[model samples]
Target: MYAVIRVRGRTGIKKNIADNLNMLNLTRISHATVIPETPSYDGMLQKGKDYITWGEISEDTLKELISVRGRLPGDKRVTDEYVKENTDYDSVDALATAIFNQETTMKDAGLKPIFRLNPPRKGYEGTKKPYTEGGSLGYRSENINELIEKMI
Candidate 1:
Protein backbone atom coordinates (compact mmCIF):
# COMPACT_ATOMS: atom_id res chain seq x y z
CA MET A 1 0.00 0.00 0.00
CA TYR A 2 1.07 3.56 -0.58
CA ALA A 3 1.74 4.94 2.85
CA VAL A 4 1.36 8.64 3.51
CA ILE A 5 2.14 11.03 6.34
CA ARG A 6 0.84 14.56 6.28
CA VAL A 7 3.40 17.27 6.92
CA ARG A 8 3.68 21.03 6.58
CA GLY A 9 6.55 23.54 6.75
CA ARG A 10 8.92 20.65 7.48
CA THR A 11 10.75 20.88 4.20
CA GLY A 12 13.84 18.79 4.78
CA ILE A 13 13.67 15.14 5.75
CA LYS A 14 14.70 14.01 9.16
CA LYS A 15 15.91 10.61 10.34
CA ASN A 16 12.41 9.70 11.51
CA ILE A 17 10.78 9.27 8.10
CA ALA A 18 13.83 7.52 6.67
CA ASP A 19 13.99 5.05 9.54
CA ASN A 20 10.27 4.46 9.53
CA LEU A 21 10.17 3.95 5.80
CA ASN A 22 13.11 1.62 6.10
CA MET A 23 11.28 -0.50 8.67
CA LEU A 24 8.18 -0.44 6.53
CA ASN A 25 10.24 -1.58 3.53
CA LEU A 26 8.42 0.78 1.22
CA THR A 27 9.34 3.85 -0.76
CA ARG A 28 8.80 7.13 0.96
CA ILE A 29 7.29 10.09 -0.82
CA SER A 30 9.83 12.07 -2.77
CA HIS A 31 11.04 15.53 -1.91
CA ALA A 32 9.72 18.37 -4.08
CA THR A 33 11.25 19.47 -7.40
CA VAL A 34 10.82 22.72 -9.23
CA ILE A 35 9.78 22.79 -12.89
CA PRO A 36 12.38 24.52 -15.12
CA GLU A 37 10.72 26.13 -18.10
CA THR A 38 10.42 29.89 -18.36
CA PRO A 39 10.34 32.51 -21.07
CA SER A 40 14.02 33.10 -20.35
CA TYR A 41 15.22 29.49 -20.48
CA ASP A 42 13.30 29.18 -23.70
CA GLY A 43 14.88 32.29 -25.02
CA MET A 44 18.32 31.01 -24.07
CA LEU A 45 17.87 27.53 -25.56
CA GLN A 46 15.10 27.62 -28.09
CA LYS A 47 15.94 28.75 -31.58
CA GLY A 48 12.65 30.47 -32.37
CA LYS A 49 8.98 30.46 -31.56
CA ASP A 50 8.28 28.03 -34.38
CA TYR A 51 9.17 24.36 -34.81
CA ILE A 52 12.86 24.85 -35.39
CA THR A 53 15.34 21.98 -35.03
CA TRP A 54 18.82 22.04 -33.48
CA GLY A 55 20.77 19.19 -35.10
CA GLU A 56 21.45 16.25 -32.73
CA ILE A 57 19.04 18.12 -30.52
CA SER A 58 15.52 17.16 -31.51
CA GLU A 59 12.30 18.41 -29.96
CA ASP A 60 12.50 15.74 -27.30
CA THR A 61 16.11 16.64 -26.58
CA LEU A 62 15.27 20.30 -26.39
CA LYS A 63 12.37 19.55 -24.10
CA GLU A 64 14.51 17.37 -21.88
CA LEU A 65 17.14 20.06 -21.91
CA ILE A 66 14.44 22.57 -21.15
CA SER A 67 13.18 20.30 -18.41
CA VAL A 68 16.73 19.97 -17.18
CA ARG A 69 17.20 23.65 -17.72
CA GLY A 70 13.91 24.22 -15.89
CA ARG A 71 14.52 21.69 -12.99
CA LEU A 72 11.94 18.85 -13.08
CA PRO A 73 14.60 16.18 -13.04
CA GLY A 74 12.68 13.64 -10.94
CA ASP A 75 10.06 13.13 -13.62
CA LYS A 76 11.47 10.90 -16.34
CA ARG A 77 9.61 12.57 -19.16
CA VAL A 78 11.18 15.84 -18.11
CA THR A 79 14.69 14.49 -17.63
CA ASP A 80 15.34 11.06 -19.08
CA GLU A 81 13.02 11.27 -22.04
CA TYR A 82 15.82 12.90 -23.97
CA VAL A 83 17.83 9.72 -23.77
CA LYS A 84 16.96 7.13 -26.35
CA GLU A 85 13.82 5.29 -25.23
CA ASN A 86 15.63 1.95 -25.54
CA THR A 87 18.73 3.08 -23.70
CA ASP A 88 20.26 0.50 -21.36
CA TYR A 89 18.90 0.18 -17.85
CA ASP A 90 22.21 1.01 -16.23
CA SER A 91 22.49 4.17 -18.25
CA VAL A 92 19.00 5.18 -17.30
CA ASP A 93 19.64 4.38 -13.67
CA ALA A 94 22.80 6.44 -13.72
CA LEU A 95 21.00 9.34 -15.26
CA ALA A 96 18.16 9.10 -12.79
CA THR A 97 20.50 9.01 -9.85
CA ALA A 98 22.58 11.87 -11.13
CA ILE A 99 19.77 14.09 -12.28
CA PHE A 100 16.60 13.32 -10.34
CA ASN A 101 18.25 13.76 -6.97
CA GLN A 102 18.92 17.38 -7.80
CA GLU A 103 15.43 18.72 -7.10
CA THR A 104 14.19 22.28 -6.77
CA THR A 105 11.03 23.96 -5.48
CA MET A 106 9.35 26.66 -7.56
CA LYS A 107 7.07 28.89 -5.54
CA ASP A 108 5.01 31.06 -7.85
CA ALA A 109 3.22 33.91 -6.14
CA GLY A 110 -0.11 33.94 -7.98
CA LEU A 111 -1.40 30.53 -6.83
CA LYS A 112 -2.27 29.54 -3.31
CA PRO A 113 0.19 27.00 -1.96
CA ILE A 114 -0.92 23.37 -1.58
CA PHE A 115 2.02 21.03 -1.82
CA ARG A 116 1.61 17.26 -2.22
CA LEU A 117 3.69 14.08 -2.16
CA ASN A 118 2.96 12.75 -5.57
CA PRO A 119 2.48 13.82 -9.13
CA PRO A 120 -1.10 14.61 -10.00
CA ARG A 121 -2.84 11.58 -11.49
CA LYS A 122 -5.01 13.61 -13.86
CA GLY A 123 -2.87 16.71 -14.27
CA TYR A 124 -4.36 19.56 -12.24
CA GLU A 125 -6.97 17.19 -10.76
CA GLY A 126 -4.56 16.54 -7.91
CA THR A 127 -3.97 18.78 -4.90
CA LYS A 128 -1.10 21.04 -5.96
CA LYS A 129 1.02 21.81 -8.94
CA PRO A 130 4.62 20.59 -9.11
CA TYR A 131 7.38 22.97 -7.99
CA THR A 132 10.01 24.53 -10.24
CA GLU A 133 13.74 24.75 -9.72
CA GLY A 134 14.06 27.84 -7.59
CA GLY A 135 10.86 29.04 -9.23
CA SER A 136 7.54 29.08 -7.47
CA LEU A 137 5.22 26.40 -8.85
CA GLY A 138 2.58 29.01 -9.07
CA TYR A 139 2.23 28.68 -5.32
CA ARG A 140 0.41 31.89 -4.58
CA SER A 141 -0.32 32.80 -8.16
CA GLU A 142 -3.84 33.59 -9.34
CA ASN A 143 -3.06 31.21 -12.24
CA ILE A 144 -3.46 28.16 -10.01
CA ASN A 145 -5.76 26.37 -12.43
CA GLU A 146 -3.64 27.14 -15.43
CA LEU A 147 -0.42 26.25 -13.63
CA ILE A 148 -1.89 23.01 -12.35
CA GLU A 149 -3.37 22.24 -15.76
CA LYS A 150 -0.25 23.01 -17.76
CA MET A 151 2.66 22.35 -15.37
CA ILE A 152 1.52 19.83 -12.79
Candidate 2:
Protein backbone atom coordinates (compact mmCIF):
# COMPACT_ATOMS: atom_id res chain seq x y z
CA MET A 1 0.00 0.00 0.00
CA TYR A 2 0.98 3.65 -0.35
CA ALA A 3 0.73 6.36 2.25
CA VAL A 4 -0.34 9.77 0.94
CA ILE A 5 0.08 12.73 3.25
CA ARG A 6 -0.95 16.35 2.93
CA VAL A 7 2.20 18.38 3.35
CA ARG A 8 0.85 21.84 2.73
CA GLY A 9 -2.13 23.82 3.92
CA ARG A 10 -5.09 24.33 1.66
CA THR A 11 -5.08 27.86 0.29
CA GLY A 12 -4.80 29.18 -3.25
CA ILE A 13 -4.68 25.59 -4.49
CA LYS A 14 -5.93 25.03 -8.02
CA LYS A 15 -9.27 23.33 -8.54
CA ASN A 16 -7.85 20.12 -10.04
CA ILE A 17 -5.31 19.67 -7.26
CA ALA A 18 -7.97 20.35 -4.70
CA ASP A 19 -10.20 17.79 -6.36
CA ASN A 20 -7.48 15.16 -6.32
CA LEU A 21 -6.79 15.87 -2.66
CA ASN A 22 -10.44 15.52 -1.91
CA MET A 23 -10.58 12.22 -3.78
CA LEU A 24 -7.56 10.99 -1.86
CA ASN A 25 -9.30 12.05 1.39
CA LEU A 26 -6.40 14.24 2.42
CA THR A 27 -8.45 17.37 2.97
CA ARG A 28 -6.42 18.87 5.80
CA ILE A 29 -2.81 19.66 6.53
CA SER A 30 -0.98 16.80 8.28
CA HIS A 31 -3.69 14.40 7.26
CA ALA A 32 -2.81 11.03 5.72
CA THR A 33 -4.52 8.09 4.11
CA VAL A 34 -3.37 4.65 3.06
CA ILE A 35 -4.21 3.75 -0.52
CA PRO A 36 -3.69 0.80 -2.75
CA GLU A 37 -1.09 1.15 -5.50
CA THR A 38 -3.44 1.36 -8.43
CA PRO A 39 -3.15 3.38 -11.62
CA SER A 40 -5.95 5.73 -10.58
CA TYR A 41 -4.30 6.44 -7.22
CA ASP A 42 -0.97 7.05 -8.97
CA GLY A 43 -2.55 9.60 -11.24
CA MET A 44 -4.15 11.42 -8.35
CA LEU A 45 -0.85 11.46 -6.44
CA GLN A 46 0.98 12.78 -9.46
CA LYS A 47 -1.54 15.52 -9.98
CA GLY A 48 -1.28 16.62 -6.36
CA LYS A 49 2.44 16.05 -5.80
CA ASP A 50 3.11 19.69 -5.20
CA TYR A 51 0.87 19.69 -2.13
CA ILE A 52 1.44 16.20 -0.77
CA THR A 53 4.02 13.49 -0.12
CA TRP A 54 3.56 9.78 -0.70
CA GLY A 55 5.44 6.50 -0.62
CA GLU A 56 5.37 2.86 0.37
CA ILE A 57 4.89 2.27 4.09
CA SER A 58 6.66 -0.31 6.25
CA GLU A 59 5.00 -3.08 8.25
CA ASP A 60 6.17 -1.70 11.59
CA THR A 61 4.79 1.73 10.88
CA LEU A 62 1.63 0.25 9.48
CA LYS A 63 1.03 -1.67 12.70
CA GLU A 64 1.45 1.40 14.86
CA LEU A 65 -0.80 3.42 12.60
CA ILE A 66 -3.51 0.78 12.75
CA SER A 67 -3.28 0.44 16.49
CA VAL A 68 -3.32 4.16 17.11
CA ARG A 69 -5.52 5.41 14.30
CA GLY A 70 -7.54 2.52 12.93
CA ARG A 71 -11.22 3.03 13.65
CA LEU A 72 -14.36 0.95 13.11
CA PRO A 73 -17.58 2.00 11.39
CA GLY A 74 -18.98 3.70 14.48
CA ASP A 75 -15.63 5.44 15.24
CA LYS A 76 -14.44 2.78 17.66
CA ARG A 77 -10.76 1.85 17.94
CA VAL A 78 -9.77 -1.54 16.58
CA THR A 79 -8.56 -4.18 18.96
CA ASP A 80 -6.89 -7.51 18.22
CA GLU A 81 -10.16 -9.36 18.72
CA TYR A 82 -11.97 -6.98 16.43
CA VAL A 83 -9.43 -7.58 13.71
CA LYS A 84 -9.72 -11.32 14.14
CA GLU A 85 -13.52 -11.31 14.20
CA ASN A 86 -14.04 -8.98 11.26
CA THR A 87 -11.16 -10.01 8.99
CA ASP A 88 -9.25 -13.14 8.17
CA TYR A 89 -6.20 -11.96 10.00
CA ASP A 90 -5.63 -13.19 13.54
CA SER A 91 -3.81 -10.11 14.69
CA VAL A 92 -2.90 -6.58 13.67
CA ASP A 93 0.59 -7.71 12.67
CA ALA A 94 -0.85 -10.26 10.28
CA LEU A 95 -3.14 -7.65 8.82
CA ALA A 96 -0.26 -5.22 8.52
CA THR A 97 1.80 -7.85 6.74
CA ALA A 98 -0.94 -8.38 4.22
CA ILE A 99 -1.16 -4.64 3.63
CA PHE A 100 2.58 -4.48 3.00
CA ASN A 101 2.23 -7.34 0.57
CA GLN A 102 -0.56 -5.50 -1.22
CA GLU A 103 -3.01 -8.25 -0.39
CA THR A 104 -5.29 -5.88 1.55
CA THR A 105 -5.96 -2.21 2.12
CA MET A 106 -6.93 -0.10 5.12
CA LYS A 107 -10.49 -0.10 3.87
CA ASP A 108 -10.54 -3.88 3.70
CA ALA A 109 -9.59 -4.00 7.36
CA GLY A 110 -12.26 -1.45 8.38
CA LEU A 111 -9.97 1.49 8.97
CA LYS A 112 -11.10 5.05 8.49
CA PRO A 113 -10.01 6.51 5.18
CA ILE A 114 -8.22 9.44 6.79
CA PHE A 115 -5.52 9.54 9.48
CA ARG A 116 -5.38 12.80 11.40
CA LEU A 117 -1.68 12.82 12.23
CA ASN A 118 0.02 15.07 14.69
CA PRO A 119 2.40 17.51 13.08
CA PRO A 120 5.94 16.15 13.16
CA ARG A 121 7.27 16.70 16.65
CA LYS A 122 10.31 18.63 15.51
CA GLY A 123 8.50 20.14 12.53
CA TYR A 124 9.27 19.43 8.88
CA GLU A 125 12.22 20.98 7.10
CA GLY A 126 9.84 22.91 4.87
CA THR A 127 6.88 22.13 2.64
CA LYS A 128 7.83 23.95 -0.55
CA LYS A 129 10.49 21.79 -2.18
CA PRO A 130 10.74 18.13 -3.10
CA TYR A 131 11.84 15.52 -0.56
CA THR A 132 15.15 15.16 -2.38
CA GLU A 133 15.91 18.71 -1.34
CA GLY A 134 14.89 18.11 2.31
CA GLY A 135 11.41 19.58 1.99
CA SER A 136 8.17 17.73 2.74
CA LEU A 137 6.48 17.53 -0.65
CA GLY A 138 6.87 14.82 -3.32
CA TYR A 139 7.66 11.15 -2.79
CA ARG A 140 10.03 9.86 -0.12
CA SER A 141 10.08 6.19 -1.08
CA GLU A 142 10.23 3.79 1.92
CA ASN A 143 11.48 6.64 4.08
CA ILE A 144 7.92 7.89 4.23
CA ASN A 145 7.33 5.56 7.19
CA GLU A 146 10.06 7.36 9.13
CA LEU A 147 8.35 10.67 8.62
CA ILE A 148 5.05 9.13 9.64
CA GLU A 149 6.58 7.87 12.86
CA LYS A 150 7.70 11.35 13.86
CA MET A 151 4.22 12.67 13.23
CA ILE A 152 2.56 9.77 15.04
Candidate 3:
Protein backbone atom coordinates (compact mmCIF):
# COMPACT_ATOMS: atom_id res chain seq x y z
CA MET A 1 0.00 0.00 0.00
CA TYR A 2 1.53 3.28 -1.13
CA ALA A 3 0.83 6.41 0.81
CA VAL A 4 -0.36 9.15 -1.52
CA ILE A 5 0.24 12.67 -0.29
CA ARG A 6 -1.19 15.69 -2.03
CA VAL A 7 1.41 18.44 -2.60
CA ARG A 8 0.82 22.18 -2.70
CA GLY A 9 3.73 24.62 -2.74
CA ARG A 10 4.03 28.35 -3.02
CA THR A 11 5.32 30.09 -6.11
CA GLY A 12 5.46 32.87 -3.57
CA ILE A 13 7.92 31.59 -0.96
CA LYS A 14 8.93 28.37 -2.76
CA LYS A 15 9.58 29.76 -6.21
CA ASN A 16 13.12 28.41 -6.13
CA ILE A 17 11.84 24.83 -6.30
CA ALA A 18 9.40 25.53 -9.09
CA ASP A 19 10.78 23.17 -11.73
CA ASN A 20 12.06 20.22 -9.73
CA LEU A 21 8.89 19.89 -7.68
CA ASN A 22 6.40 21.02 -10.30
CA MET A 23 5.24 17.53 -11.32
CA LEU A 24 5.07 16.17 -7.79
CA ASN A 25 2.33 16.18 -5.14
CA LEU A 26 3.40 16.83 -1.59
CA THR A 27 2.10 19.51 0.72
CA ARG A 28 5.30 19.85 2.71
CA ILE A 29 8.88 18.66 2.58
CA SER A 30 9.76 15.71 4.77
CA HIS A 31 13.02 17.58 5.19
CA ALA A 32 14.31 20.98 4.10
CA THR A 33 17.47 21.83 2.16
CA VAL A 34 19.35 25.11 1.91
CA ILE A 35 22.39 26.22 -0.08
CA PRO A 36 24.34 29.47 -0.49
CA GLU A 37 25.70 29.83 -4.02
CA THR A 38 23.47 29.58 -7.07
CA PRO A 39 25.19 28.54 -10.32
CA SER A 40 25.11 30.95 -13.25
CA TYR A 41 25.10 29.64 -16.81
CA ASP A 42 26.83 32.83 -17.97
CA GLY A 43 29.85 32.29 -15.74
CA MET A 44 33.08 31.89 -17.76
CA LEU A 45 30.92 31.94 -20.91
CA GLN A 46 31.27 34.50 -23.70
CA LYS A 47 27.77 35.83 -23.13
CA GLY A 48 25.80 38.60 -21.46
CA LYS A 49 24.29 38.54 -17.94
CA ASP A 50 21.72 35.79 -17.31
CA TYR A 51 19.76 34.67 -14.31
CA ILE A 52 22.17 32.78 -12.08
CA THR A 53 19.73 30.04 -11.20
CA TRP A 54 20.51 27.08 -9.02
CA GLY A 55 18.54 24.49 -7.08
CA GLU A 56 17.70 20.83 -7.50
CA ILE A 57 15.88 19.55 -10.58
CA SER A 58 16.17 19.92 -14.33
CA GLU A 59 13.54 19.06 -16.93
CA ASP A 60 15.96 17.56 -19.45
CA THR A 61 17.86 15.54 -16.86
CA LEU A 62 14.69 14.36 -15.19
CA LYS A 63 13.30 13.10 -18.47
CA GLU A 64 16.60 11.39 -19.22
CA LEU A 65 16.61 9.79 -15.79
CA ILE A 66 13.13 8.41 -16.22
CA SER A 67 13.86 7.15 -19.71
CA VAL A 68 17.13 5.63 -18.60
CA ARG A 69 15.54 3.93 -15.64
CA GLY A 70 12.72 2.72 -17.82
CA ARG A 71 15.29 0.91 -19.98
CA LEU A 72 17.37 -0.49 -17.15
CA PRO A 73 16.93 -3.74 -15.25
CA GLY A 74 14.80 -3.65 -12.07
CA ASP A 75 13.01 -0.58 -13.47
CA LYS A 76 9.71 -1.59 -14.93
CA ARG A 77 7.88 1.73 -14.78
CA VAL A 78 8.30 2.12 -18.55
CA THR A 79 5.81 -0.67 -19.11
CA ASP A 80 3.27 1.29 -17.17
CA GLU A 81 0.34 1.69 -19.50
CA TYR A 82 -0.59 4.72 -17.49
CA VAL A 83 2.75 6.37 -18.21
CA LYS A 84 2.92 5.25 -21.82
CA GLU A 85 -0.52 6.61 -22.59
CA ASN A 86 -0.01 10.02 -21.04
CA THR A 87 1.87 12.50 -23.22
CA ASP A 88 3.09 14.37 -20.16
CA TYR A 89 4.87 12.31 -17.55
CA ASP A 90 3.51 13.32 -14.19
CA SER A 91 5.69 13.43 -11.12
CA VAL A 92 6.47 9.98 -9.75
CA ASP A 93 4.44 10.72 -6.65
CA ALA A 94 0.76 10.26 -5.80
CA LEU A 95 -0.13 12.01 -9.04
CA ALA A 96 0.96 8.84 -10.81
CA THR A 97 -0.12 6.74 -7.84
CA ALA A 98 -3.77 7.50 -8.55
CA ILE A 99 -3.26 5.61 -11.80
CA PHE A 100 -1.68 2.28 -10.67
CA ASN A 101 -0.83 1.77 -7.07
CA GLN A 102 1.59 -1.14 -7.26
CA GLU A 103 3.08 0.11 -4.04
CA THR A 104 4.45 3.64 -4.56
CA THR A 105 7.07 5.38 -2.51
CA MET A 106 7.39 9.10 -1.70
CA LYS A 107 10.67 10.89 -2.35
CA ASP A 108 11.63 14.24 -0.83
CA ALA A 109 14.10 15.95 -3.12
CA GLY A 110 12.73 19.44 -2.70
CA LEU A 111 9.48 21.05 -1.68
CA LYS A 112 7.76 18.64 -4.07
CA PRO A 113 7.10 14.96 -3.58
CA ILE A 114 8.58 12.82 -6.33
CA PHE A 115 7.40 9.24 -6.80
CA ARG A 116 8.54 5.93 -8.35
CA LEU A 117 6.09 3.08 -8.75
CA ASN A 118 6.93 -0.35 -7.46
CA PRO A 119 7.29 -2.67 -10.44
CA PRO A 120 5.06 -5.72 -10.49
CA ARG A 121 7.54 -8.54 -10.39
CA LYS A 122 10.05 -6.03 -11.81
CA GLY A 123 7.68 -4.31 -14.28
CA TYR A 124 4.21 -3.12 -15.14
CA GLU A 125 1.58 -5.73 -16.05
CA GLY A 126 -1.13 -3.11 -16.49
CA THR A 127 -3.25 -3.69 -13.40
CA LYS A 128 -5.31 -6.28 -15.23
CA LYS A 129 -3.58 -9.16 -16.96
CA PRO A 130 -3.11 -12.87 -16.53
CA TYR A 131 0.62 -12.46 -16.75
CA THR A 132 1.22 -15.28 -14.37
CA GLU A 133 -0.55 -18.29 -12.95
CA GLY A 134 -1.21 -17.09 -9.43
CA GLY A 135 2.16 -15.34 -9.40
CA SER A 136 4.32 -18.42 -9.86
CA LEU A 137 8.05 -18.62 -10.53
CA GLY A 138 7.70 -20.47 -13.79
CA TYR A 139 5.09 -18.01 -14.90
CA ARG A 140 7.50 -15.17 -14.12
CA SER A 141 10.50 -16.80 -15.82
CA GLU A 142 8.41 -17.30 -18.91
CA ASN A 143 7.62 -13.59 -19.00
CA ILE A 144 10.82 -12.27 -17.50
CA ASN A 145 12.09 -10.57 -20.63
CA GLU A 146 8.74 -8.99 -21.34
CA LEU A 147 8.57 -7.83 -17.77
CA ILE A 148 12.00 -6.22 -17.97
CA GLU A 149 11.31 -4.43 -21.23
CA LYS A 150 7.87 -3.32 -20.19
CA MET A 151 9.07 -1.84 -16.93
CA ILE A 152 10.92 0.83 -18.83
Candidate with best TM-score: 2
Worst 10 residues of 3 by lDDT: 44-53
lDDT of 2 by residue, 1-152 (tens): 89888989889999988988999999999999888889988988989999999999877898899788777788898888998999999998888788778798778778787888999988988989999998989989998998999998
- Model 2 bad stretches (over 4 Å): none
Off by over 4 Å in 3: 1-55, 70-75, 79-82, 85-152
Clashes of each: 24, 0, 11
Candidate 3 positional error at 125, Å: 41
* Cα misplacement distance, residue 79 of candidate 1 (Å): 6.5
lDDT of 3 by residue, 26-108 (tens): 22422111121223321211121011111233223333334444222343454344443542335433333332332322232
Give candidate 1 misplaced runs (Cα > 4 Å). 1-6, 9-76, 79-81, 84-91, 100-116, 119-152
- For candidate 1, the per-residue lDDT at 137 reads 28
